[model samples]
Every structure is written in structure tokens, then in C-alpha cells.
Target: SATLRIELSRPSSSEFTFDERVNRSHCSVSVTNMSQQSLAALVIAYSILKRRRKSEQKRSCWVKPWIMQQSEFSACSMLAKELRIEDPLQFRNFVRMSSQQLQLMVELLGPIIGKKDTKFRTAISVHDRVMVTLRFLASGDSYNSLQYLFRIPTCTIGSKGTIVQKYEVFPDTREEWQRHAEAFNVQWNFPHCLGALDGKHIVIQAPANGGSHYFNYKGTHSIVLLGVANANYQFTYIDVRCNGRVSDGGVFQNCSLYDLLENGSASLPDHEPLPGRNMPVPHFFVADDAFAIRSYILKPYPFRDQPAPNRIFNYKLSRARRIVENAFGIMANKFRVLRKPINLSADITANIVLAVCALHNFLLSTRDSRENYLTPGVADSEHPETHEIIPGNWREDSTSGNSFFSLERGKRDNYTTSQRDVREEFKEYFMTPSGEVAWQYRHIV
Candidate 1:
């Protein structure tokens, strides 16, 4: 074996190799019998490698030339501008909002998302930021795809959750609740109803170290989006990003809305008599069997073999509850971002869901866009002449598949006397002339 010696030394520029100085190994082999020619070749090789590393560290350009031409070539600059002038329908299809609506959004969110320019470069405009965000919401395209289409950096575009305020769509006072109640009574024949309550699973990527917290009965990772919608299919209140493992009843019980209602700070209207009836009933939301039988929550009577009165009650309750379902369906069908598994982090996914919910309400707010946004037969409709249920276009597409799924019904628990009494009152009212509809019997059969 050749004898080896280790020598520790501080680096001298021409003496030690780059690895030894950077790695701080501080030791070099000194083979006394090695040829001088071999040592000279090794030093030359190290010098070449060091030179190559420095060249590789240099950036090719500050910004790509194509990115610099975004003002002229970007989708927002070209397609959006052209559509804003020539075709409004096509513009809504592209950005998921009318041009006027887009501008309004910029005005509303400008202060929050706007950035100030630095000496090095100009900040992205608030209008451009909103446009990019809307495109992300409409298409659910990856950030890389958005970067090239919008000519914005991938890091700059994403859905922000800062806009999910309930006061924008939800009722805040007894007067507001009364208005919603009137709408439900007129539209769905459900008296003293505030809105429809429901929940759907929003699939998301498994989070790091999440274990089974985000896992659901469907064998996928998800979060729940529980919402309350008025009769017109607009969301009034939404509790987003509840753990998928929890039942809808559990999620509702633990949410802030429930806390407020329990504390009597939710501004719920006092119990009032049903239309044309002497008995007063609590104002409540209609949901499916997945929820509890609370005084404020009216779920349909379980089991299909119910008596005639019970079946009629279920039919009417389902008709009212359909608003929330159709709200989810129309959203998933239009936005399409909700149709597939979201690959973002849990926090970002929550923000995206909330953003779309806000966008849904915003789309409904505009008189010009509202009619076209929810056109005739786009959502489930009742035949004017025959009263038959005509499935919406969304229902046809939903059959293909989507991330939207219902929660499993929770185990039956003994309901309080008051809860049981509320359901019975509604059941009895459906048989009365005031609550009964000419077509309800035909539809129930």
C-alpha cells in the first residue's frame, strides 16, 4: 500500500483546490513520490471547473423579452380589450364576468391587493391582478399556464380569501331575515323559512403531516363547504374549509355561525305565525337528512315510507333545499375550478373556495349579468304549465363526475321535544290549504 499523509492548512489562492476551501475539510493528501506532472494536470482541471461554475451563476436576462411585451401581447391586453369593445358575451365566457363587473372588482379590492412600485421596477397594476385572479378562478389552470397567458409571474397570481364577508350577501338584522323569509315563502311554499342549508365536499391535495384529518368517507382528502342560500340561489352565509372527516352536523355545531345563533347575536327574527295560520313557527333553514333536527334547522323526515302529510312536507322542504344544491351545481359547472381536485395547499384551497363563493354572489348582484348568468333552464326549473321538474344543464354535466359530493348522514340522536314539535308543525301545515299547492300532490306522487 502507498503511504498517505494528511496535512491541514489555510488556503493560498494558487495552492489549495476550491472544494477544500469551500467544504472546509482543511486537509490535503501529500504523496511524496507522485510525479510533478500529475499534480500540475489536477490543478489545471480544478481551475477550469471553477471558471465554469462562475459562468453558470450569471443570469441570462433580468426578464425575458417576451414577458416585457406583455402590455401588447398578453391575453388581458389583447383578448380582454377586444372583447370589451366588440362582444360582451364572449368576454363573460373568458373572464367569467362582464367587463363592467371586472372594473368594479378592481375598485372594490384595489386597496387590499395593490402594490407600490420600487426604484427597480413598476408594480403590477390592480386591474391586471384582478383579471389574472378571475382567470385562475374560471379555469383552474396551473400557475405556469396562467403565467404565459397573462404574462404575469407565477408567484403573483392566486385566489385571495380576503373578500368572504357575509354582510355582502347574508342578512345582518331582523329586517333582512324577514325579506329572505318572504322570498322563501313565495318561491318554495315554505313559510317562515330563512334559507336553505347544505354542505359539499371540496377535494384538495393531502397536506403535509396531515395524517387522516383531511380524509373523508369517500376515500379522498377534502374540506367541507357548508353554505346557506336564499331562495334565489345566492349564498347568504358560508362556513368554508371544515375538516372532511367531520359530519355536516358536527361542522355546523362547531362553526362560528352556530356560536352566534346560540348566543342570540345572529339577529334571527322572532318566531312568527305561518302564512294564513294561527300557530307561530320559528324561522328556520331547510336541509337534507345529514343535519340535526334543531329548532332553527328543519330537515326532512327520514325513511321513504312516510304518511301522505309527511311525504308532502319532505317534497316542499326538498324544493326549498334545492336552492343550495343548485347553487353548488351552477358554481361548479360555471367556474369549473371546483370540478376537479385542487392541488393547492389547504389554506390556499380554502381561499380559492371562498373567492369563488364571493364571485358567485357578485355575479348575481349585477342586474345586467344576473339574467344571463343564470339563464332559463341553466338551473333546475319547474314547468310553468305542468309543474314537472326539468333538470338543469348542470345536472347533465354533473353526471360525468366532479369533486362536489354530499356528506354521509350522521347517526340518529334523540331530538328535543321542541325540535320534534317544529317538524310536526311544518308537516301539519303542508296539508293545510294555505301551504298546499295544486301541483304539489301531483309532484309528490
Candidate 2:
């Protein structure tokens, strides 16, 4: 029972073996018993076997010379070129600027965006930094979404904390307002029109402990961007990153743009006579029913009764005011980011809003080659081009401002005597020969 027996009737010898045969329960082996050449052969064979196995099956890894060598900028350029994205429109749709414009942009903003020196540490190229920032702003796409396309840690580049800086983007100046007024007068025939004012709710995640603070009447969490856009759909005055719950009127009342207007620092053009009349009309910001009617900010009369004059007022105001809608529509269409909710903090949201607005102004300044594709007509609730203010029969009152002061005055609860007078003046002005449109009577319901 003490003897251990193993039965192998016919044993076979295998290659590359260091063999030992057990003789008893307590067995001992001596190195002197084995031949030196045999031991050397075993060692060599074992080593060869290990190397062969390693050669046959090795650990998988991903690495390539080209991938390792190319930087982010080089890679992006190579990709854009390889895809044949040469056309301006194609480039605009992809990265929101033409190739030339992109180069000029890199020249302008490069040094300021941390591309100053790479002698001390490895730094990202200016082109790479700007392209990433632009792509983020134009598409409203997230850093995670762009990784596969750009092969970069996009969230880390050109941003302090997921925010493109506001100082980099330029807003409309006093001269810009003059230019905007000229454009509105020339194109839409609405003289002294500074820009169309509107607000859009940029949806966002429920802020930390932000219960209803961000909840809007639209039944969504958002930050409102109140933009005053010129006829070319460029933002002249931007009141960005307001609470989503605030009304258009509320935003206007509280914004710095409005403050400038109130404090007389906006340097707006003085009240000027209408094109066909001597009564000077003050430059005003066009808005919808969401805003209160003011001497400087004109809104359409309440859409209740069917007076010929009131209908004309609605039609005319709608004609000019719808530009805001068109501007917002074009912006949302171009930057699909506006169409989706942005998931970021308030500070970051404000910075992003500023950047997008600036990009809008840049594109407008550059002027897109394809006219109809990017320039949408004024948006109307009823139709794209709803009001036809060319000509019609409502020209009964020919004398300008005649009997305009004596019209029936029904006002909103908040309207003061002077505010009502301004609205009435505009209404009668439309009924007068100077303000009347030939199609006013024809379009009336």
C-alpha cells in the first residue's frame, strides 16, 4: 500500500521535455546524472518553445505611425480635404465658415487663444483650437459627439470649462445699428427700424437644486436669449442667458441693451422723418405681442376686433416683426444646437450664446454666396411671406397725421396716456397717405 504504482504499458517520449520519473514516496534527483548536452538541449528547446508560442499569439494593441505622428490640426485639415469639402456652402454647413474666412479667423484670434508659445510645453495649433471652437458653436454639438470625427478630447480645448469666452465675440456697434436701419428701410421699407427683437428658449438640464428657477412657461427648462437682429439676420443687440421663465418684455426691461437705450448711451440715430413724410418717427425695435408697446418699441394692436386701421397695423407690424422669427429660424436651422437643449451651467450657457451670436454676425458680414439657401424670408404665423404691404384701398386719410390724434383709444391695463398716443399715432399714420399701404384693405379679414 505504501508503494505508489503508475501504469503506462507503452510510454512515449515527447520533444522539448525535462523528464523526471517518480521511483518512491520520497524521491531524490541528482543534476550530475544528466548529460550536459541533453540539459543544454532541454534549456534551448524550452526557450525556443516559449518564443514560438509568443510569436504565434501576441497581445493585441492599437497603434499606427500615421496616427501617432499627425497632430489634431493636421488630422482635421487632411480629413476636410480628403472629403472634398471645398465649396463655401459645404464648409459653412460643416464648420460654419468659409475656408478663407477660417484662415482669416485663425490669423485674428490665434494668439489670444493660448497659441502663443509651444517652446515650453506641447501646445495645440491655432487652427485646431479655432476649428474645434467653431464646430462646437455652429453645430451646438457636444464634445463627446465630436470625438469620433475629430479624434480629439474636444471638451478640453480652447475652453476654460466647456465655455467659449464672450470677450472674443463682437456685438453690433452704434455704426452697425445705422447700417441695420438702412438695410431695413431699403429692403422691408420699415424706416427707422433698428432691428427685430425676439427671444428663444435654450433648453438645459435641471440645474443642481434649480427646481423651478429654470422652468419656463413653454413647459421646458431653458435659458432665454433675447436677440435684436438686423435685416440681414445679424444680431445687433444680444441679451443672452436670461432665466427661461422671464418674458420677452421682462428681458428687455432688465437687459443692458435696454439700459443703454434708457440711459441714452446706445448712440441711436435721432428720430428721422419718414421716407414720404415730414413727421419724424423715432427709431424703434420691432417686436411681437410678447412685448409691451412703447414709444420706441412698437407692437401690433391686439388681434381682436376687425377695424381696417387695426388690421393694417397688425399686417404692417407683422410684416416687419416677422423678421425676428425668420432670423431665429435661420439661426436654429444653421446651428441645430439651438433646436436641441444645451446641457451646461448658466455661465457656460451665456458664453456659448455670446459666441454663437458673434458667429452669426461674422457670417452675415462675410455674406454667403448662395443667396436663397441661407437667407430665409420673414417668417409669419400664417405664411412665410404673409403680409403684402405694396398697395390697396385703405388710403382714405391722405393728409399725414391728420385726425390721427382723435382716433378711438382702447389701451392695455398697463398702457399710460402717452404710450396709447404713440400707438394711435402709428395707427393713424398707417391710415394716412404717408403710412397707408395699397394692400392694407385687400388683406383685411
Measured by TM-score, the strongest candidate is 1
Residues 17-129 of candidate 2 have per-residue lDDT tens digits of: 22211111122222444566656755665566556544545334443333333374453666655543545456656676667767877776755775454553355567777
- The candidate that wins on lDDT is 1
Q: Each candidate's TM vs. the true structure? A: 0.85, 0.69
**Candidate 2 residue runs with Cα over 4 Å from true position:** 1-75, 84-89, 116-121, 158-179, 272-281, 368-413
- lDDT of model 2, residue 141: 67
What is the C-alpha local distance difference test score of candidate 2?
0.61
lDDT of 1 at 379: 96
Tell me the tens digit of each residue's lDDT in model 1 across 40-151: 7556655665575555454657767887777889998998999989998889888888887788888888878888988756777788888888888788888899999989
Candidate 1 has what TM-score?
A: 0.85
